[model samples]
Target chain A: MIEQDWIWGLVGGLMIGSAAALYLLVNGRIMGASGIIGGLVDRSGWEGGTERAAFLAGLVLVPMLVVPLYETVETHITSNLAVVIVAGLLVGVGTRLANGCTSGHGVCGISRLSLRGIVATVFYLLGGALVMALARHVLGVI
Target chain B: MLRLLSALVAGGLFGAGLLVSGMVDTTKVQGWLDVFGDWNPTLAFVLGGAIVPMAIAWRVAERRKVAVLGGPLPLMTEGEARPGRNLIIGSTVFGAGWALAGLCPGPALASLTFGGTGGIVFVVAMAAGMLAAPPIRARLDRMQPA
Candidate 1:
C-alpha cells in the first residue's frame, strides 16, 4: 500500500493546492483548515461565520460523496483511548496557540514564503519526529 | 451567496484531495514520520504537490487588489510575518499530536464520516482542546512575558 501510493499523494496534493488556489482567488481566504474551525469553535472569527460554516460543511460532507469511489478508507488511528485524547488535546491547543496548522503554516504559509510559516513548519516537523521516536521507539506506545 | 458557494467548492476539493492523497490514513502519516522504522515518503509528494498551485496562486494574488469575486485578498500583517515563541512552541506541540495519532486537522475532519468512533472521539477532544487554548495562551504569555 505504501509503495504504490506516492502517485496518489501527488495527485491529491495537486487537488489540495488547486483548492487553496481557488479559495484564495475567489474567496480571498487562506484555506487553513484549523483556523477556519478555530474561528467557529472559539467565536473569534464569528464575523465570517457563515462563510466558514459553509466551507466546513463542504469539508465534512463532500468527502462522503467520494468514499464510494475507493475500496477502503482506513485511518489506522490508535486504539488506546488515552493516546487519542491526549493527542487530540495537543493538536487542538497547539494549532490554536500557533495560529495555524499544516494547511495554514505548511501549505499556505510556505507557498508564500512567510517566515513565520516556514519557522512553524520546521518546528512542528521536528517536534513530531522527536515525539514519534520517543513514543514508538523508546516508550513503546502509540 | 457566491462567496459561500466558492468556499464550499474549495472545501470540497480540499476534502477530496485529502481522501485521494491517502492523507486520511494514519499508518501512512506515521510511516512518513517513522524515520527509525520503515519510512514512507509519500507525504513529501503530497506537500510538494500542494505547494505548486498555491505558489502560483500567490503570484497571481500579488497583482490583484481583491479576489476575483470582490473580497479583499489576504495581506500578511506585521505580526504574522514575524516568528515568535508561541509559533515555535505551539507548532511543536501540534506536531507531537499529529505524529502520535497520525492525524492533523484536515485529515481528521475529512475522515470523520468513515473514521469510526475513534475519529469522533478525537474530533471532540480536539475541539475541547481548542476551547481550552485561549486560557492556556494567556497563561503562557504571562509566564514568558513575550
Candidate 2:
C-alpha cells in the first residue's frame, strides 16, 4: 500500500500556494515561516511586526480549530529531549542563516524561478537525504 | 486592519495546507527523506501543488507595482536575488536538523497546540536559536570580502 494520500497532498499544496499568492499579491510579502518569526525575534523587520504577528497567530491558532475536526495530528518526533532541542535549535538558526525555508525556498522561491531558491532547495534536500541515510542506515541514531 | 486580516487569512490557509497535505506529520516527512527506505512521495505532490498557483501569482505580481493592500511588493532587483554561501551552508544545516526531527518551523508552531511538552520545548529552543542567529550572521557577513 502507498499509505500516503497524494490527492490531499496536492489539494493542500494548492491551498498553500494560494496562501502564498494572497500574501504576495495582497500584503506584498513572501510567506516564509522562518523569515516571519526570525524578523520578530531579531527585531530587524519590526515595521511589519503586527502583520507578522497576525500571520503567526493564524498559523498557531487556525490549526487548533481545524485539527480537531479530523483525525488527530500525529508526529514521529524522537523521544530524546536532547535530540529534539538540538534539532529545533539547528532549524531555527539554519533557516535564519539561509534567509528562507521550505515555504520560502521550496515553494515560493522555486515557483518564482529564483536561482537562489533553487540552489537552496537542492542543497537542503540533498542534506536531508544524506543525513537520513547516515542516521537511519549507518549510525541508526535517529 | 485589512493588512492584518489578510496576513491572518494567508497564515490560516498555510497552516491548513500543512495539516491537510500531511506536511505536519513528521513520520511522512521523514519517510519522504528516506530515499533508501520506503520513501514517500507525498511531499513532492505538496510542493508541486503549491507551485502552480504561486507561479501564477508571481506572474500577476510582475505586472503590479504595489500590493492590493498598498504595501510594496517583494519583487526582487537584479543583483539582490543572488545565492551565496550563507544560503547553501544554512540550508544544509537546516536539512540535517529537519531530517533528524522531521519538523520545520511552520509545522512546529502549528503542532504546538497538540504537540505537548516536547513541542513546547522544541519551539522555545528554536526561538533561542533564532535569537542567536543575528550575531552569527553578522560575523559571517564580516568575514565576507569587501
Candidate 3:
C-alpha cells in the first residue's frame, strides 16, 4: 500500500512539476501558490493580477471538476479549532515574510538550487519536525 | 489572453496534480511528517518527482530570454538569490503552522471543495496572514542596515 502511495505521489509530483514548468516556460511565472495569491493581496504585482486570477480560478475550479470522478479527498486536520486558526495565521504570515512557500521555495527554489530556497526548506523542515515533536508528544494539543 | 489561458491551464494542471498525487490528503502529509510515528516516505517521492522535471525546465529556461507568450521568464538575477533572515524566520513559522494544520496553500486551496469548514477557515486566515505581512516586512526592512 505504501509503495502504491509512493507511485501515485511520484506521478502526481511529475504532474506538478510539469504544470510549474509550463507556467515558467509559457507564462514566465514561478507558479508559487502563496506568492501568486500574496502578490494579489499585497497589491505588489498588480500588473499581473489578471493572470494570477486566471491561474487561481483554474486551480480552484479544476479540482472540483476532477474530485467527483474519484474517491473523496480526505484530510486529517487537527480537531482543535484554535490550532487550526493559529496554524493558518502562522502559515499565512510565514510564507509571505519568507517570500515563498513549498511551491516557490521547496519546489521551484530547490530545483534551481537557489541558496534562499535551500535554506528556507531546511529551516521549515526543522521547524516542522520540532513543532510536531512538541505538539503531538509533549503538549498533546494538536 | 493567451497568457491568461496558459495560466489557467497551468493552475488547473497543478490542482489536478495535487489531487492525483495524494497531496490533498492531510493524513498523508501528516503521516509523512510524523517522523516519530508511522512515518510515510510518500512525500519524498513526490518531491523527487517534482524536482527532476523542474530541474530540466530550469535548464531549458536558461536559454530563453522570453516566455512562450513573450513575457519575461522569472529567472533570478544574481542579486535576487541571496539568502537572508526573512527566509529563515519566515519558513520556520510557516513550517510550524504546516505541521499543526497539515496543509499548505496549494493543498489548502485544492482541498476547498471537500475540506469543509476547516479548509475555509484555513484559507481565510491564511489570507489575513498574507495581508498582515507587508507591515511586518516593512519593519524588518527598516531594521536592516543600508
Candidate 4:
C-alpha cells in the first residue's frame, strides 16, 4: 500500500502544492479554497459578486466533469446526506472563524510565510488528526 | 480588476484538470492511498494531466514576460525565515498535526466539498483549532519586539 500510495501521495501533494506554487508564482495570490469561497459568499465582504460567482461555479463543475472519465467510482460511506450538509455548514463556520480555510491557511498562507497562516494551519492539522484518531482509534467507529 | 479575472481564469483551468484527472474523487483519493491492499496507479494519470499543462504554462508565461493577471511578474517568493525558538516549536507542532490528519487545507476543502465524513470532521476540528489561536497570538505579539 505504501509503495503504490507513495506516488499517489506525491501526485496529490504535487497536484495541490504545484497548483499553489504556480498560482502564487504567476498571480502573487494564494489559491486558498476557503478564501475564494468566502469571497463568493454574501455581499458583505470585499469580493464582488461576479468574480465570486465565477469562482464558486468553477468549483462546482470541476468534479462533475470527471464523472464521465472514471466509469466505476465507488463510495463506501452512505450513512446520511444530512451529515454531509451539516459538515459543510460546520466547515463554513470554521473557515470564517479561522479567517481562512485549509487552502488559504494550509497551502497558500504557509507558502507566503504568513505567521497567522502557519498558526491556522497548525490548528487545522492538529484538529483533524485528533478527530481522526478519536473516530478511528478511540471510538472504533467510522 | 484584471488580477481577480486572471485568478478566475487560472483557477478554472486548474479545476478542469482536477475533474479530468479524477483527483476530485475522495474514494479515488483513498483508493490510491490504499496501495498495500489493491494498488492503483490511476493517480499517475492525474499527475500527468497536471504536469503537462503546467509545463506549457511555464513556457508560455516565460515567453510572455507578463502575468496573464495584472501586476509585476512575481520574482521572489522566499517564505519566512525567523531566527527564534517560537518558530521551530510552532513548525514541529504543525507537522505533527499534518501527519495525523491526511487532509491538509486544500484537500480538506476538496474533501468536504465532496461530502466525506472524515473530511467534514477534519474541517470542523481544524476550524476549532484555528479559532483558538487569535487570543494566543495577541498575547504573544505583545511580548515580541517590534
Q: Compare the candidates by TM-score and give the number of the best one.
A: 1
- Candidate 2 residue spans exceeding 4 A from truth: A1-4, B76-79, B142-146
State each model's CA lDDT, in order. Answer: 0.91, 0.88, 0.87, 0.48
lDDT-sorted candidate list, best first = 1, 2, 3, 4
lDDT (10s digit) by residue, model 1, range A70-124: 7876788888989999999999999999999999999999998899899999998
Candidate 3 has a TM-score of 0.96
Estimate the overall C-alpha local distance difference test score of candidate 1: 0.91
DockQ of candidate model 1 = 0.85
lDDT of 3 by residue, B31-123 (tens): 777789778899898888888889888888888868888867777443464688888889999999998898989989888887888888998
Clashing pairs in 1: none
Best by lDDT: 1
Q: What lDDT does candidate 1 reach at residue B84?
A: 86
DockQ of each: 0.85, 0.82, 0.82, 0.18
- Deviating ranges (above 4 Å) for candidate 4: A25-28, A72-78, B1-5, B16-68, B72-146
- Candidate 3 lDDT over residue span A26-128, tens digit each: 8888979999988888798798799999999889999988888877556666667788899999999999999999899989989988888889999988888
Worst 10 residues of 1 chain A by lDDT: A65-74
Residue B41 displacement (Å), model 4: 16
Give the lowest summed-lDDT range of ten residues in model 2 chain A: A70-79
